[model samples]
Target: MTSTLLSAIPRELDVGTRRSAAIAQFISTARQLIGDPSQASREDLEAVARHLETLGRQATLFPEEDFPVDQEHPAVVYRLSEEADGGFALYLSAALPGKSVLPHDHTTWAIISGVQGVERNVFYRRDKTADPARDALTPERTVDVGLGNSVILGPDDVHTIELQGHQTGLHLHFYGRGLDHMPARVVFESRAGGSYRTFGPPAGIRHARITPQDLKAALADGQEIALLDVRDAGVYARSHLLFAVSAPRWRLPLDIDRLVPRRNTRIVVIDGDESQAHDGAHQLIRLGWTNVSVLAGGTEAWAAAGLEVFSGTNVPSKAFGEVIEHEKQTPWITSEELERLVRQGDNIAVVDSRTPEEFAAFSLPFAHSVPGAELVYRIAEIAPDPETLVVVNCAGRTRSIVGAQTLIDAGIPNRVVSLRNGTMDWLLTGRTLAHGRQTPLPEPSAGHLAGARAQADAVAHRAGVRRIDAATLQRWQESARQQQRTLYLFDIRTRAEYEAGHLEGWRWAPGGQLVQATDEYAATRGARIVLADWDGVRALTTGAWLAQLGWDVSVHAPATHGPGAARVTGPEPVRVLVPDSPAPLIAPAQAAALQQSGAAVLIDIDSRAAYEKRHPAGARFVAPGRLSEFIPTLPAQASVVLISADGILAHSVASGLLRSAKPAQPLLALRGGTRGWIAAELPTDSGGDGVVTGDDDQSYSPYLQKDLALRNAGFVEYLEWELGLVAQLEREGHTGIALID
Candidate 1:
């Protein structure tokens, strides 16, 4: 059977194709050993496990890009091979830090072996004193499984898996049968005092198939659906359903949780064909996402149905911006006109309607960073004279037009117009941009605050944005916690203001960036969005736009004196699971001493840019995620010390290193990282020569490309795409977006 399968495959093929061929051979051998997986003996299972581990050691066949770790779900499982009868199933599991699975029984024999990083496996034993029905279990033993390690389990063996710290883990698992066929698997919810609750028989996974026409109908009826294109980001950006979000299959585990927080939200995945979509749907189900479906024929079917597919990121928001421009005839001036006005010394206040960072990077001369929602709230302060001409600009069309119209709609007395095509056009027309300008719009004066508030309130109400009190917000938060629905709470203020003071539980999403990248802020299509701000104008204005974008949005302002009214200070905290035992920390002086005396090998795990800026002399640079690869290269007795920009990353790296295959030795993280060393006035080297590992950790957007011509072309292509969105949307028969009367 293996020979026959191999003969069907082409002799010359890609690594993935070759890997598939090898998988077929491995499965054939496994079948010969196990005979019938359900009746396989202990020796048979052990033999099969050994073969699987040997196959797993061929890490070159499994690229890390095929398994991305994002902010969504911490782990993803890729099906490597499975028998026709669903026996002898094999999977590649890639897990990022902070992943924890409850004690669970596979109901079949299984073997797990590591290819990279560390995975802690804790075996559990059912308590003899407890009733079988109680499902009570206690930890029996724990093992740190990494490279050159494997754990085998019987059909009824129960175990929990955890990945701690910052590194990602790549492991191979061989199971008696595929997960889709395992309807009787048991998950033990262990509690205090050895008590446990059984999740009972697994809910049978199902992926509903929806045709392109039906999906269009659902959207036309304004049904809440997250149409996700599960293709690669680059591919998805080229062409995708207008409303579909780019939730790549590889990134689904890392991004799906945040992109579509509600597991039960209607999620439809699409790829080139139904193959990837079906796989993505199954993975989503395994990750506890209840409502998932596959597009019947994926993007090809949609295009075949005569529905126009869009080319760009944030299609919905960008299209809506175009639609608004078309409907409202938002006034605009070309780059030439703006330059002429500037040269004539006209009474104009150029407001960059983008984030402060973007405005500071490259903005028109004399332009102040007023940002998106702030255009309405602070226009009164920016262009105090009603006769002043206010020109709004963003990187390109969307925010420029939207921000300009926002001011006009808010009844600002000034004459407002957008800089056509924004900075992109300004550059294209041979005009220069000013860099590092720090003029941000200030708060509205006491005299104009009331008027701005009233205008914003009227606009929000007109757009059907609801105003919720603190009590209602609390109820919604509780309901969201209970998983009854998905709710997103955003403080629509500038980061500076948000960090200075914000509601404790709310996340800081600056109003402009939130609008610019709505998918990033909220992935659940039907999820409720609640905006917070000290004053009502910013939240209301932001909510008004959100409502226009077909979101169920509400604005809230907590009472001045109340239990939940106190504002917290500092940046929002990130949540990640730390190791059971803390990473050992050595103070900067001690670490320096150790390094100077050749007792410790100092490794800098900060970003390439940070490492090149100023790292401790003689320190070696390696990307944190690739630390495991570097660990084995050192001498067996080499004392390792990790350093990052801050001590936090060093601690995480150190914790993950302890679980690697390195020999037992004292491994310590530099306390306070490089910051502490620099603060202590330690000697430092400033160059990239110490970097042993190349920089490829981050993906750059088209606009951020280093190639000058490519960047310019990207800007042009992007602007053109945005301009064409409204036309495409018009051509489509069904759309959820609707402008308010």
Candidate 2:
């Protein structure tokens, strides 16, 4: 390897093809092993974290329009790419003056390391008793809490911090998978009925693109030095300099704290022909990208110099199947085991980290309703035996493991093992379930909160998990559509019920590979995913797992009412009411029906998607990363329309779609869509057929640069790099990175 001033470089060239990089094979093998977004082996994730650890060239920063903000210290951001499971992984931040946000939470766990300034953290929880809808933004005041002033957020704990507003704040954040992939990310809206209305599921999140302008130039008179491009393979191939090789953007995160090896290394970013590579050059110079000078025009100028180039290759990310072949540990414990452990006088403290109700109706023998928030302080009073094995169990493992790991990391002197297979495992073993509520240990203290926070480090622990309620499963059975949002319900329960009583469409997703395998259900970025664990809690947390991805999400919190245990929630299955009736189809029948229902969803069925591949008129792709958020703006009673595909696929995918979108009227397919009108032929024109239509504002992704020509490079440079980072800080927050200035 050639030496350079930029230090902390990763060892070895991580080489692998796109095909070889797949957990199994992206399509064929991953298809069999993968479940929903909610399930992926922790080991697989750890491995991904490791693979991502590899070093790459200093990534090129691009120039793009700023997010509109009235505040001088506007919290601005630019996003990069996302992680494998589904969380916003790459993005930078800038702070705002006053209040940063309305108290909210990111879908999954995250790491908010300070890349710039000092920040104050504030946390909020939904007032369970308040009407979800009547809960206006200013309706409730915030709980100002102190968590030791700092500008860092580790991977697991959720936090909201205020930027003192002195300078621009920058934070490097890490998420579950990729930013756009978050599940059940409904924008909170108040309905007249005083309930929160959810929107559509995330359809397609935008991918980043890098264009010539994104590159910064640090020219030294004539430029007789070396150039280093630290972007990803996709960006490199779309267009790059012949001499430039791929050094990933990961360099800053993994290596920088260490060293930059040499001096005099004139590192120049080859991020195409445009933007000044100064930010990267600035970063490197700070890290000693000595004599660093960005190529005059980046790779574009170089390539335009008729330099050689490379494309169609892939950089190695983490290996996916690390846990697929291994036996997965059940995320929870069985009732009988809890009984036996309690009965045997074992020093085991079984903490039930479920909601209060779940703890009440039916619980493991002697497990206490420790509830996730109360796990910390109640530990000693509940368990007392520090040396004893502290077993944490939820219906399944996602939360239990997280809860238990919480203990482990806090240095709690107990062996924390999630019940291998949880309650389902016990039942599968023919153990009659025991039910009873265990009293709370106490109100908990600061020590408990601290301990809980410590354990939160494992929050990023992506356990192989998935879930769905019986009602949700039944609903999927009815009016199932063709392709739009198909939910391949995988019943992890026994084959008998699956064969005998399981909802009609559900397929069996046994407990085994469901961990290592993540592509099974909800494989398409656009498809809604649902997992059913007849075993209850398993589905809720599993759904929580998916919800973390910001994809629309909800679990069947099934009613205690037996047999048909799962009730198909009717009415607005997934509602979307457009702010205004732009599309043609506000028919009297549709209008009257919409007005009558509790959840009338009004969307331009002809809005987004179907037309991307050249469709008739009336359907356009939902703006990337926004299918579900806007859905809530519509009337809840009506069906979210999909005028594309003539409406078939949308209806089919509705059930699964609702999994992420939450409750909504079943999707209503607009027959013939806009095409039907043009054909039966009504008047229609282009909403944009996947092409870069115009800068008239109506025809663009907010994240996309208005003038971007090269789609791939442009996205990376403008959207992800420029706009993404700004938006990110708004989500995870920024309190620390400001000092770097």
Candidate 3:
């Protein structure tokens, strides 16, 4: 019976299934041997290691073909399980040849069992007489770990492994606590009689893995789980798991707060590649996520397991909008009907509820840009007459729904409706869009202000939004600092309003955009957020949505006098203190002369895209991150002049180069940088030469690409992506978004 169970499965069955089954057995056995890693005895850990070695020896358990070593990312980690409190983690690691790991302590009990090839493990012992502040590691012994060979390390064990042989190697590692969770680990170097340094572990952890079936079961059981797809927008628009929110891998750390909000929420991340999913899960864990996991095989495994996948960005939010529209039978007007109404001189006001840039690019005739969150604030100004009809629109349906509903919820007396499907639908119906029309909302009258204030106050009360005076807000700010919590003061009004006059110390974040992309503005989950506006309407409306989103939000009304009084002027001048360096500063003309004379090589330290746009003639682009590697590539005798968009980056780069051993040449920073050169009317060029040191930091949108076919395809895919979001939301279960009647 055991032989039958261990027999090789058919080739048709995915390798993920077999690997998952083996990992499940290992998890079960480990749990039985050591119920809780933190409380487990040394003997218990050793017994668990022995069982793992037996499993490793079974060819059926860990087929070599299933665990291929990647050459690019040599260490591929497959997490099997982790204790709830992060006390322990089990994983399968594949290491390719030419890998050499420096000597380091795990800081916790760890076990390793080899399944393929060979690895040389060197053990190290700390010197008793060494200073406590520094690390002094002495080599003790070596062990050859081949197939079925196992090594068990106590909490204080230190070792290093090198895969010097010609073949790739695979091993299973179990840690008392995941490496990422370990606050500090010591690394040793044998340079100049050896020195040691303490550094944080790698960014990610070997987070728990879940099978598609398990995820499906969890959803069926109504578990509150956040399924995130960590892929680029283009890929996410192509296909993703149902109800999965699009939080690209690169933006996960920045955007996680808005998507999940609560660190304790159960999260399952998926990507096209297992490595990316694992890395993303680790990043989340590193950011204080307590319950995070990765899908074993990503979307492929989920599909293979007969689960549905979806497509698009903001799938849940878009879908929720659709549900609200359908259930409430939200009022909407077709493009043709709206055009007819305009032609007939109907008493209607059209408002574009998108970004100002988007509205400026193209908009409907007679439309003014009043973004979603500002709709309630500026509606009275746009349509003072209670009988006037109001129409809201965006590039698509979501913002339109939100904008129209916001006004409706605020008890605005004007008849309101969303432009069905927004601009895309208008274009499909052969309506020509007007470009560069800057129609501004009229100044509010006394009646308009009074009505808007009353409506906004009502909505805020309904959303349970608290309104604090300046004194109370200051108290909260001071309390937050004392408690080690974050407090964000955002001026939620139009950019024009913010720039013309605003309160000191309040950073400008427009109300509509803030609600749309809360993650971009506030990173700290559960942080206190205070919204401020000249008029009470904008702040209250924006505060309502933030409060609903689970933020500890409040609206602050500026005082008539004192520190909270609004400032009526442009932004305060910023004073930056640059570090004094011995390196010389060259003027634009002097640098130009040096370049022409071939005495100095210009290296731009700004973003690759910015550098490519415009830079001093003969300038080579080098990203700041690749400065060390790029310095060695430069001619040792050539005087290097570093410049950035501004002088800040230039000064910083020059300072670092002066300290480095390489570049054996005189390094200088341009006095003002590329902006100064441009201001001085110096010769500039736009294009990259043969020199490139690192990856470009900016990613261009597929829809914005020059290729007509690609752009058109992206648009088509985007529309389909948006269309499917409503269905996906219904499948996932209703998200707790309130649509006011």
Candidate 4:
């Protein structure tokens, strides 16, 4: 019967010419057979699977290059429809070899048909004898899905997939309802003592994609949505859909908490490829985001649909900065004028409010690094003479505007102005940048300190910021713990100052940048926030903005612990406890001896760039995600030693390797990772030649390109991107954001 179905296809027809039509026909037939996919029966799904198999065989007729898999992400999903609510969904999926997915059950009935390479499907059955709350899965059967083969899984089915062979595998899948909208799906894991635990589904599933027309309608109707461009800043700077914020794919996980604190907010992710959008949607879903979707076909599709696109990074913030400048008429000085004043030995003080690293990279002449948060605290020392003019600058306008305005709000006696357009404008006007300077602020006098405190109190009062005592803060902390609410206690000070001495539970965030990039620090919209500093100036200045931003904010006036009390140096260490392993851990010296004996194979799991900069001699760089692909290539009998920047990542990777079905060799983690090796005076090597597997996790940014022309173009485009944000925000109806006067 299957042979008869295969013979029906035109023998001489070109695959490329007939592919889309064939897939469309299959979709049409599947819809007819399984109308109202949510109500599809087991037999109805199986028939659809069989039809998919017939169509899958024709996959060879199409060009393989068209369905390429992303190495980093490993899978590419070609969405065929946008129906996400109890509606049918068709997707073409392609994955590279050696990919192993964890066991999971689709909340809806699913059918898969293989087109290329081989896929090993392992099926599991739920053990009814186990407690209802604790799921137990027992492996039942394994099926090798080859070209023309098909498999149908009921809603309750559980399975894991392993891509076989050394080639990419392609498959066509149809689901009863979209997988992205099914948050009740289960991921089963084997626990100790023959038990199984079913991990809860992600926060929420997002719709797969949104058409440009639909998005336009939503905007026109004033719907609330966060259009996020999950591409590199350089790519985003080049061109992107209107109102789309630049949130790089790699950094999205880290930044999403702060960027989209309201979990229920509708988020639409845009990217050039379906894989990035699909992966981004899944990531947000895992993080418990309730409403998310990918922009169908990305910017190209939007452009094709005759929609406007823009370029740049942080456009909204930049546009708001411009608005503030225009409305408030913020004081400003041209770089050339400032340079002339400095040359004339004028009584002016220049302060760079950027991070220490950025200030060190480049700054105006005689500028001191007093990061935004430290501006109020150290301003007395920076411009002690009330007659001295104070000029603040950053890499661009936002920080400069905010910092200069902050000083003004505090009623600083000195004449203050922002360097208009900041360093970018300075460079455009042919001014030179001073590099690698470390000028520190002068010590503050008693009178200067007293004046700053008084100014801060006034500003905080006007902003309606509250002052909290230690007892009140403790009550809030206890409430947060009991209610599962977020409470952030931040020390608004310089990194050096915070490292020297800070309250035990408080994390350090520079006041200026914290306000500028609030999404990076606070992920909960209504969370209580407390700002602390040695003197009250920095805390009050930072707290005032937080209050205006709608945060439940308070300033801790008196120091909880005076300088050096409850102190800890450096950032907190990340510790992930894995199951105890029998493999022995070797110190740097011991590993060196083992390497000399030709028994040690070191795998460095740090970032590719970090590995190339310096890695222990003979260490091969491999990303943790691609460890499965690299494992088979390692020497069969060599003892493997995993090393990351720290031992935490190495321990996790080693644990994963131990859990694999076919463990090749004994795996161990370096006691302290590469840092320990360096501390032990071990030799290191540099360069990409040491990379054994592909480095797909790190993406190349055009802004960071070595080509001077490309770099300059990126900067120019970035400014244009920023300029259009305000208009886009207005058009998109983003009511959640506000620009304070």
For every candidate, C-alpha RMSD to the true structure in Å:
16.1, 28.2, 12.3, 15.1
Per-residue alpha-carbon lDDT of candidate 2 for residues 380-478, written as tens digits (9 for 90 to 100)? 667656777788776544456545644553456667766654554444455545655547446435665455434433332333223355555566545
Tell me how far the alpha carbon of residue 387 in candidate 4 is from the true structure, in angstroms, after superposition: 3.7
The TM-score obtained by model 1 is 0.61
Ranking by lDDT: 1, 3, 4, 2
Candidate 4, residues 265-378: lDDT per residue as tens digits?
557788875445765665455444545667877888887887766554444445556655655678999888988899999999888888888787778767888888678778
Model 3, span 1-741: residue lDDT tens: 122333543343333344444554566677778886777788887788777776677655555444444555577665555543455677767778867778777778888888877778888886644555556677788887777778888767778888758877777788888654676777777511156667765534344567778777665443345677675555555567755666655445345654555555557788865656875675565454545667878888987776677655444446656765766677899999999999999999999988888888788868888887778766887787889999999887878877887888888888999998888777666677888977666667787788888998988888878888767877877775553345778888777777888876677778877776564466444467888856878888888777765567788777777655648677533332222244578999998998898888898866666676788878887654455667777777778898878776677557645633336777888989999999999999886673475333333333244565665565566667666666666655534455444
Q: What is the C-alpha lDDT of each candidate?
A: 0.75, 0.39, 0.69, 0.69
How many Å off is the CA of 42 in candidate 4? 28
State the displacement of the C-alpha of residue 480, model 3, in Å, after optimal TM-score superposition: 3.6
TM per prediction: 0.61, 0.25, 0.58, 0.58
lDDT, model 2 = 0.39
Q: Taking the tens digit of each residue's C-alpha lDDT, what string does model 1 give over 1-741?
A: 233554554554434434555665677788888788899998887777666666666666566654554576456676655543456767778777878888887888998888787888999776655455565667889888777678888888889889855778888888888775576776765521143444542222224456778677666543346778776565667678877887755345456666777655667788766656865675565455544556777888889988787776777787888998999999999999998988999999999988888777778887888889787788888788999999999888999988988988888888999999998898878778888888846878887898999999999989999989888998998988875668988998888888988888788888877887897668767679999857879999999889888889998887788677798999976543342245789988888888788788998875666787789888988755456667777876668998888777677657645633333667888999999999999989988788876543322344455577887887888888788877887797556576776
Clashes of each: 4, 130, 2, 6
Candidate 2 runs further than 4 Å off: 1-6, 10-73, 83-88, 130-159, 186-741
